[model samples]
Target: MRTIAYFLVITLICCLAPSADLSAQLNEPAPIRLRNASFEDIPRNSRAPVGWYNCGFPAETPPDVHPDPMNQFQVGMGPQHGRTYLGMVVRDNDTWESVGQELSEPLVAGQCYDFWINLARSKVYLSQSRVSNKPANYVTPAKLRIHAGYDFCDRQELIGESDMVRNYNWQEYAIKLSPTEDYTHLVFEVFYETPTLIPYNGNLLLDNASTLIPSPCEEVVAVNSPLVNDDQKEPISTDPVPGPVVVTQPTTKSGDPQPDPEPQVQLGQSKQVLAVDAVFEVPDITFVANESELTPESSASLQEIVDFLTIYDNVIIEIGGHASQKATADFANRVSMRRAGSVVEYLRTRGIDPRRMFPKGYGKSKPVCYDESADCKRRNQRVDVKVLKIE
Candidate 1:
């Protein structure tokens, strides 16, 4: 009778196990917990904050927990929330740091979620060099990118990003996600301006990450054809089978073909690029005394030229370089050539076709202001982009 009782007890325990497991599963949270969301739970003597792990390679160092009291890493400012935040660096060796965590629950498909995080960058950052084995060089600010993914470690979907965050104060950034598939992970990374070509040491601070909340789906409006008549009635079909509706492409009238529409280009301001003809002076492209390299100011002006040429693909321009009277004619000509070449190279880097651009050096032959005053000299040392051809 005792042996029989033991067998019955074993059977009862087995029967209750599955139900208990199901109950626990049902009680699990639907939304992600966003563990260590504020990054307040850091442990002493550790590079990474609690509940977060390095998403980079095994050799790569994890992100540092900061308000670094020992002055090992310079954050320039305090954390945005709590007493600490996470900091990641992109070193000169092309290796960047990233941190990530698995969400408490996976994101559901077809759901819109509102997510936000606080981001900041130090004006400067210092680190130890792997090559020199001494204190590494300090670098300027870079951008930060946040990614989301379904897998724990593979965060391939970019959710939010910032242009070079050079500010010392913390700034809040938000991104809305309309996920197609269930995503369960988030990653924060530091990157240079041009990630593939340039590798520089820069620091990015992350803190006060907000939990994802369900957002309302965007409403879409249906556009009806202007040609459709509201009072028109459909004729009763005599045949049982219906024919497929055919869409006709728009065509020009035979004798009077309409010209293609003028391309619209939005520089800092909006403008229309017509096929006829136009001329605009690039007055801001001023160079430092005889230097062929573009300064930060010159780069901004050149970027405007790039934007203009990009939209008007059929347009061709001559990049004319000039110099001040301080240099000899031969020296000035060479300097001018170099300056023109520099502008062409910059435009090429910006994805403009080289064939459409012509670079010429004027050698101070053509000056907007011919006087010998400082203002005139500055005006003479300029690059002019003249529209040569437009289709």
Candidate 2:
């Protein structure tokens, strides 16, 4: 069994490794750092928050989500036939440039590392063209090259490309790289071609572009049982999926087992963490005297939830209902499951997309209050709302 498990782990790693010998190089430690190379600020747009950057161009404009650019990049809005309802454009003669810091002073050779870019839009191309291809209108090409070693046109290497058919709203773009030899510096280049002699002003929006020495899979696996390994599972655990109001015990504050002094701040000088606009709390529609169910008072709470969703046409939410210790394990599990299903059914009637909402029920496994008292048990028998992802 042990041998089988070991083989499983190794097979997992081997199967998971991408081409280009990148996985080998990720195992080595790279001094991680960030270099903020941002362009001038343009008016904010609701769609894409992170601005654009330059790769090799002398002058490039920053990214602006707004419909129009005040100066420089002639920003315009367009619609992708099958993609998003709207998209951004770079006016003639405007280019954007940004820089990223190496994870280490000099990238180490022969260690595995992974690189990814957090993307706000997907199916877009990061293209490379010949020095003579200087027409702005020839923007998108049928194919784009992918690699980490393409700063100057001379060292362009295609690592791997992303699926460009589907629309991934502001997601992460990652790639692994392994060096055949060491080079102190590398350049990044992005462009696209679409079989036309259009102007060639390059345009794209990106953020959190990074290169890092990946931690060993074993350490990460130990810490997070279901780390995003060969299976490509979701990073967050969904077993009991956490709920809205997660109450964690405060950490020890003093060396002598004594409390630290409370923090103080002047009025109006402090900032309050903002809450997500989407409301995802479990509706108070049901609970038992010693169970998880509806007691008639839940209707109002449930209605409030429905109303909230109706008001925000674009909002999406997740509901996680929990049970108390009063019930047996089997009973609690069934009750929690029922509550979750009921909530989903109720919301469906309210015209919310079933695809947008995720309902999970965790019986006594996740309790707000650990005590066995009646009051504590009641408090534990609660529902929670969380905004999983906002559009």
Candidate 3:
């Protein structure tokens, strides 16, 4: 009888333990569904897909519902999920295209969620460039940005974004969206590979968007549906750490009244669809030897950081610096710290919030390679931006 009582108590404890975890889990509302999410629209040019409204700037052209049967601008890609898909562009003139819809339920702040969408690029999105006023291929790859706003195209909070859509065929992007506040509206916009630095010509194709589903804060990325990039990250921001494309104007041979251009405004954002431990190498970011001053040639590369920070407003990052073993530990530590702080300062000049970033120097403590060769030393001397928190 005593043995039976012990087994009963053990079973009760085991069952009760999981229930205790429920307290940490949020009481998320039901899974939200979108109306006509697959973008079932009749083929048309300069118009948004059915059920999704145009969210671009005033007088700016709306996204197109393709494959126009007419094959306007040479965008004839077939839909992977339905009869039609959405096409949008970013132009050198500083304007882009987007669409938005009301959410079935408002996303609660501090709750975690994710959604899936199919994205690709068109090889021959033929259009004229505003800078050249001549026929230019809008082929430079672009990306999809997901924003949460209260009204049409408000873009109040950026919730998710995909890596550059380089592939021509349709590929699914699983984006984790962690909103900083409650939002009743959502917007889908196409942006350049880097959001404001170059505002060049590029296009993005989108279709078959899935509804936002509540997910565990620590839920792992979908194994069967991998992220478009090799890295696995969740959308969280850490405060006090620091960080951080193509646009094409859509117009055909036929003369149409060009839309009023929006003033040049660049948005620096955080990585919302990322895991907290994610580390990214900012390409072409280099500094003078033993000095914290960034090399002049690194301007374009550094601009990429500005664009990323503009969109991810709800997260914080760590600008971690490293040094080779050639220098003594003390020297290396100071060098790395100054370099990391220099990167943070550069972003501050570009108008990023200083509170979102802090610097740390690993010095020679963490080397990618130990050899004394220049190649190995250069490899070890690098900078990494680590996401520390998502607010």
Candidate 4:
């Protein structure tokens, strides 16, 4: 009898013990999805993606007819007060309905998810929504009703829409969803108007687009599903320590745009879909022996570094120096320190935050190429960059 009681107790404990799975929330933190977006940073003078239909006035429409000018980054589409008709007009190839990118992976039924995007538009155009024949056009046919519902192709219910549009600059647009039944055909669309009429073209700049799944466990299960077997998630890095934060600043005050400073974690480091490895490399250059002086020849390389930091102001780096075996260890150590300090001082003079840069001397201990040859020693007796951390 005691043995039977003990067995029962053991079974109960096993059942009651916590599982390694996530909680069962309709909007849990699992199963979220994301993708690289192009709309965020509209290229100054580039063509739109393929299959994006342009169905407005013919090329004779004054400023609207011309391709974007070189170095011109602003959208020509005027405000919604009325159509001025002078900008790029593109619609998706699938529906040609002004929707953003299509979901790379289909959605599952009975589950909720969030679709997010960055949008910035002029006051002249109001972004609207709708549903239509699969390959619909922006030219609406009176009877169409655009509501929040499950798109069969994407398998999600369009639960919410954005009211904040126009003149305010780039902001996020999120569509919440919960499909009633599992289906794999449909698309959620946003346009300049509900019943788009007339040639009202306004500029819309977008970026940082993604989809969110409330539950992590659900995401794991979904990934393993036969439907998604062939659809692989972007590879994640194994190392926990990300490489470093990289910031780029302009070398000259001539008004050129700054480079991207987004902190991308090295591959496989992030547990979240939004976390990315900050990929950054210092431009290779030669320095004077035991000194922190910039040669006129090194100007091009140094300028590149400045350009990166100008755009991405949020980054931290370890500007380290090393020495060759020709010098005594202590002397090499001093040279390394001076070399590192020289680089830091130069960046400061060029307007970089001293706090964002760290200088360290490795002496002769850390050699890039450990050969006794003069050339090899020269190669190793140099300064290299290491990205330490990013927030």
Best-performing candidate as measured by lDDT: 3
Candidate 2 vs 3: which has more TM-score: 3
Cα-based TM-score, every candidate = 0.45, 0.31, 0.53, 0.41
Model 1 lDDT vs. the true structure?
0.66
How does residue 145 of candidate 3 score in lDDT?
86
Predicted candidate 1 versus true structure: per-residue lDDT over 29-139, tens digit per residue: 233447667775331223666667778657877777777656666554677776668887877777788878887778776766666667666665677776566886455
Off by over 4 Å in 4: 1-112, 122-164, 167-171, 176-201, 206-211, 214-264, 267-283, 288-315, 327-335, 345-351, 386-391
Candidate 4 per-residue lDDT, tens place, 149-262, comes to 234233244443443233233344444555554433333333444434443333443444454544222332111101112255211222122122222222223334344333
Q: Which stretches of candidate 2 lie over 4 Å from their true place?
A: 1-27, 37-54, 57-104, 120-168, 193-203, 215-391
lDDT of 3 at 232: 28
* Number of backbone collisions per candidate: 0, 48, 41, 43
* Model 2 TM-score (2 dp): 0.31
Mind giving the per-residue lDDT tens digits that candidate 2 earns over 290-365?
Answer: 5545677777777556544543335566776777787789888887777777777777865567887787778889
> Is 1 or 2 the stronger prediction by lDDT?
1
TM-score, cand. 4: 0.41
